[model samples]
Target: MTRRRTTLLTGCTALALALGTTACGGSGPVTAGGGDKALGGQTVTVAGVWSGTEQENFQKVLDAFTEKTGAKTSFVSTGDNVSTVVGSKIEGGNAPDVVMVPQVGVLKQFAGKGWLEPLSETARKSVDTHFADVWKTYGTVDGSLYGLYFKAAHKSTVWYSPGALTQAGVEPPKTYDEMLEAGRTVSDSGLAAFSVAGQDGWTLTDWFENVYLSQAGPEKYDALAAHELKWTDPSVVRALTTLGKLFKDEQLIEGGQKGALNTDFPGSVEKVFGPKPEAGMVYEGDFVAGVAKDQFGREIGEDADFFPFPAVGGGEAPVVSGGDAAVVLKDGKNAKAGMALLEYLATPEAAAVWAEAGGFLSPNKNLDPAAYGDDVSRATAKSLVGAGDSVRFDMSDQAPAAFGGTKGTGEWKLLQDFLRDPSDPEETAAQLEAAAAKAYKG
Candidate 1:
């Protein structure tokens, strides 16, 4: 079992920092627009694993904090977040006031190890209300909340190039059958319908889960992550059959079936931009847009567009995806003040600002969908709200370290082996099931 955190979301670290600063001093929704004047009299040292663009963006928030409250923040840049870095810091007694984690599972893992400070009820309600109760309850240990979410990046949606889609004569796909048909049409029109880099097993794992859960129901994936569901269920097998079927049809994916096994995420990214590219629609999260924008200098709507992971039965589930949470270090400076900041950022006002700036969903429920206003962000928010209800965290992210693919190592190996001989669906299922069992044991 491997719990691999992705590197694609470094941009999110900036969003988290801004939200952290914004979160520090609000009341409740409309009533929550104030900050703590007294807390700023002291300087607090903060450390985290953000760098590059994320750091620049965070500085904006820090500058604002320093300006507003006179609270000086000395942020140490920790290049990458690892358990060893956290352990070493705590053991060295050099803890920061707040630690922003890339995933919820890490937050819970640390909480279980008793390294985090429990936040106030105000902090909990402020951040947690933006998400479903399951997310709020799952990360809490010792009956206390330790982390708060600001930006949630949805992974289950599909991104298509608007110009490419128009060239292919395809409208946004709305159903599984329709999506498959669109894939065929694009293939016939000389472009690959789907483009997913397959070097990481979790990349394919995400596709499998989306297909399985969409065909089955949301509960199945949640239960599976909770150790309450079996891997060899009919739904799981059916999903592989679907994958195999897609494999059998070269028209459905970029560079065909072989490309899926050979194309790394980097390769897939490059493949989408050629003069006569082979792929038009790619199944990826909001972060991919940044990569595209960096490569193409285009804004989201002008270049790429995303639609809700087409409603999967019982209407549509809130656009589900992976997200990060910030925890107050028990041993750090300004514990109460950090909590105040966390509370303040989850307000609608901050959410609107953060979403517009950072290009992700802020954990502020009162924010209007239009306020986010990015074509994808607005569509995502609208689709999420329009769906029957409740947003769910990524099953892979919510699952324990071993069960989740957050670390991104073992799953790629597993996927490499699995794709080589997908002739035996049961074998692949058994292998993943064994890994899931090991995760549960841990």
Candidate 2:
């Protein structure tokens, strides 16, 4: 929900800009031989939420594209507020050739406004061959293929320091209650039990989502996402109460509520994996492993490891996920080049470029497992692609931006407030219902 937008030059392009190279191309799996230059003299622009290392990794994929097609590509970061920045660009007649949409709600909104171009036949064919039908289903809006999900994050894993858990003499928990007990034991051993990123309201939504999915089952989860069931329903209250059990105990949190409310996403991960760790556990997407390894030099499956979020009340544990979709903009100047780039992204070759770089997962079934840099990433990618209908997308992403994606209002802000004062589930549920009703109607 950050509103800061920054322009980032692709790694190859940055070097090219400095050294005056002819093209931002590299020899990799996606390279086309025999000096193929079908896309020569073309330039494609992309905008997305990825920044820092993520942006750098994605640029490798673009570099591969340039190698194969002889077309140049540039990337810009829209920060977390993809909808606002991209929307403003469209109105100003300066839309990028392609945009990486982070939320399904935003994709649908853009398509409804006629701002997105349907996928080209070549792109659709690649998707059909490489991706699961469900991935395509998410990309389609009103029977038209408009977005292709290229990056996915498995959100149900809880990462922890293996050494810290061993010191506390507790195994990975199998149930929500068991996890809390382990937290208490770990806390008693002179370390904070969990590093909760309460400042980023979206993280709190994920906490509520995993609990709601496990407790209420898939049917209720779908209904709640669609707003067919009001937020004030008993199921919502039950889920809130379940999450409150973790939040209500300030001792279990790394820096208590106030400290957590000030920590951003990366800071929360640092609390558990930094050189002088303050907490034993951190919960989020599989990307947490990337943060630990890249920033803290902790190896996955050794210093850093994870387990599925524990089941609630003996039900099957849920696999909640989030992904970024690549869509061509209808009003962009480089439509042909944009479609070509989208088509290439659908191929296994493009996916491998990032998978091999670390901290990435692809839903493309055709991509080789060996492309992943580590065993943990490979296994997690396999689980996600094989999850079938059992996997549920992020709940907040399904709602309108006003309710789900906004920084300080609606679900994000409300959940932050709940974390601060979780004594009354019913009151929280009622407030959520009021906000959701207004959001869904608008």
Candidate 3:
């Protein structure tokens, strides 16, 4: 299809807070108050999908914006339905000045409706200088810049318990076949090999993406993502057939298919890292580290560790990622203040605010590695930033919302069905193609 890929933000949030902020290079602490009063009288309202601890960490970033720029910022949680919440507010003539858009497809929909303002020159230039070209490309739509990606995630990671793996006497696998064999070995050791979050269809989509990107390669990945290649294409069938190798084995999945479908994302992670562990591993984005450490009290490096998703057919492992982008509303009462926030978010200083708080990663290339709270985060961020042109955005996020982002229909539900009965790859592929065709056409 030759279409650009889009990324969406994951639900993981920062749980740990860094001690004192150390000066980086010659700049002072990002949150330190300064005399700059350019926005003394401005009040900017922002909205996003974060809640609980995630919302708190994001507020720290907004607080730093106020300290550095002298603007008062108020934030509201839109919950998981960011598009619907923002749309309703806009229709009511009470939209927030700025929004942290989780899905690139939603950003484009808002921009196409003339609800978004093009980036100010200052914000555009800041993004140009700090972020990589791929990030800039993701934020750009129809040759105009609208969104500035602030938070990013490395989605191609498999978190495993060191103690569980050691107990099974099996090292992390290097290839897909090896991973399947290791899963059987781990299962035989009396622990389920994997904690599959079948209840959350998005996790299943991620499982499919990592496998597709590695087996079908990037060209076919993009084609499938854009709907140029139907889901029933041979490449997709191959990927699904390969994934079936794991799903078909009840011993490899904790609680089996039915049990997996009952587990949510956080519960899946807990199954492996919680006090009385039932599973050996969980596959998801790098955000798993936060849940393991904060909720389960497990150290990231020693207790919970991850390996890149194993390669397929002897090729290099692929990196599939997602991000949250910031955009200003055209009808916002505080457009100036909103634009100022975007500019601030593009700088390494602003990114450092959340980076140091733990559980967050930024695409800002200029950000210092030391800003990350731990070694695991530092290494993951480095891999994300260093991937360059080899990186692929989340495939489902690039598709239309009806097909990709919706909860009960399209890819999410269909994949959940596939997880339950993985015996027929061709039948699943045909059903997926029907849903995708309708979504893309609409």
User: Can you write out model 1's per-residue Cα lDDT over 90-134, one digit (the tens) per residue?
Assistant: 788777767767666677788877777666555555555565565
lDDT of 2: 0.85
What are the per-residue Cα lDDT tens digits for candidate 2 across 300-377? 998999988889977778889899999988777687678778777876777899999988999888888999988899
How much lDDT does candidate 1 score?
Answer: 0.63
lDDT of 3 by residue, 151-223 (tens): 9989989999999899999999989889888988998998999999999999999999999999999899888
- In candidate 1, what residue range of length 10 has the lowest lDDT sum? 1-10
lDDT of model 3, residue 393: 84
Candidate number achieving the greatest TM-score relative to the actual structure = 3
Specify the highest-lDDT model's number: 2
Candidate 3 TM-score over all chains jointly: 0.91
Which residue ranges in model 1 land beyond 4 Å of their true spot?
A: 1-36, 77-80, 128-134, 273-276, 311-318, 370-373, 385-389, 406-410
The TM-score that candidate 2 achieves is 0.89
Q: Of the candidates numbered 1 and 3, which has the greater lDDT value? A: 3
